[model samples]
Target: MAMGKVPGDSEGGDEVGFAEINITPLTDIFLVLLIIFMVTSSVIVQQAPSGGAQTGLKVNLPKGGATDVTARATDMSVAILSDGRFVLGGNIVTEDELKRAFNDAQQKDPDTIVIVQADEGVPHGTVVQVMELAKGAGLGQLAIGVREPQ
Candidate 1:
């Protein structure tokens, strides 16, 4: 709000009303909306499910003495169940399909690392076979997934 006189009016005359736009309220609304968006975005990210073996078949990973390693975007995850089932990319896959997947990954990126997650009850030979399959498909980097010792 403001007060001003007409151009020809005397300075000592009565003051006339002049409207002035106020933006404080508009600024406050935008700041509140920004905060709401930030809060909701963080909540959504925290609630989202992770993509990989964690979402695949349940496997009781054996405890290992190796240091912890985090998953990478380009890394491939393969899971072997206790009953000798093969799971790739969150789906049960045949040995042939698994080989195709490895080949595709290797063709896409030869340096792609394969992370094998075998159940504690899985046979040692099965793990070796899967590793050899990856090697045959031209994938060299391999890693074994294990849980940290309690």
Candidate 2:
């Protein structure tokens, strides 16, 4: 708030004050809050897990020299845990369920690529079995997920 005196209107030398609302402080507060929210929102979005994928799982992928593969909206993901658990599209799926899910994806899009993310400690047979299932379900495009060498 601001106060100003009307000097000429008071003949008795008594100054009358007028009140004015100052908005600079309020504007500064809003701007600070906006910046805080912007930064926090961006951090939250970056940490947020992607849908229909095993984003939360910690699979130590083997570093390789394979070409980079970009993810697409129609792509399917199969995560094989080190403990022999199978996660299909972010859900724990049995072998039968995995087969059904692959078939469903194949029917939905014949070109849908199935990316297999298996832990480095996982058995080779398990990985091969998953690949075979994907092929048996009529999915031709398959990719093995591997991290780039540092």
Candidate 3:
């Protein structure tokens, strides 16, 4: 038996045989694909629609008439949970922080609209406080976000 060639081999040569499979390139490709999938999945999760409960705040909004009030792109939403926690843009924030955010938004756009979504179980004082802060920030156009009874 020869050192590099098998007996009666068709390719007659003393060249070193490459019998091992080079999996390094395959592994690199797989890792790149995995990273792309992870980034795309995170972006999809953020853009997906939240059916109210998806936000994790669970604010039981009050029922009201189904008016044709279209939410504009410049509208800001503030949610008050039953547990007395404030949520602005899906982030839990303190009352002072919420006020500061409103003030900052108002400075950027004086006509900025704010919608307060307060749970039914939330205290009346908490709801009033949010409204007062929005108004105090010079956001003249304010609306209360409510659910229409089915």
Q: What are the Cα lDDT values of the candidates?
A: 0.87, 0.85, 0.82
lDDT of 1 by residue, 26-144 (tens): 99999999999998776545421455333333446799655566678878999999999999989999999999999999999998999999999999999999999999999999999
Residue pairs that clash (backbone atoms under 3 angstroms), model 2: none
TM-score of 1: 0.55
* Model 2 quality (TM-score): 0.55
Q: Using lDDT as the measure, what is the rank order of every candidate, best first?
A: 1, 2, 3
Worst 10 residues of 3 by lDDT: 47-56
TM-score of each: 0.55, 0.55, 0.54
Cα misplacement distance, residue 126 of candidate 1 (Å): 0.2
Off by over 4 Å in 2: 1-67
Q: How many backbone clashes does candidate 2 have?
A: 0
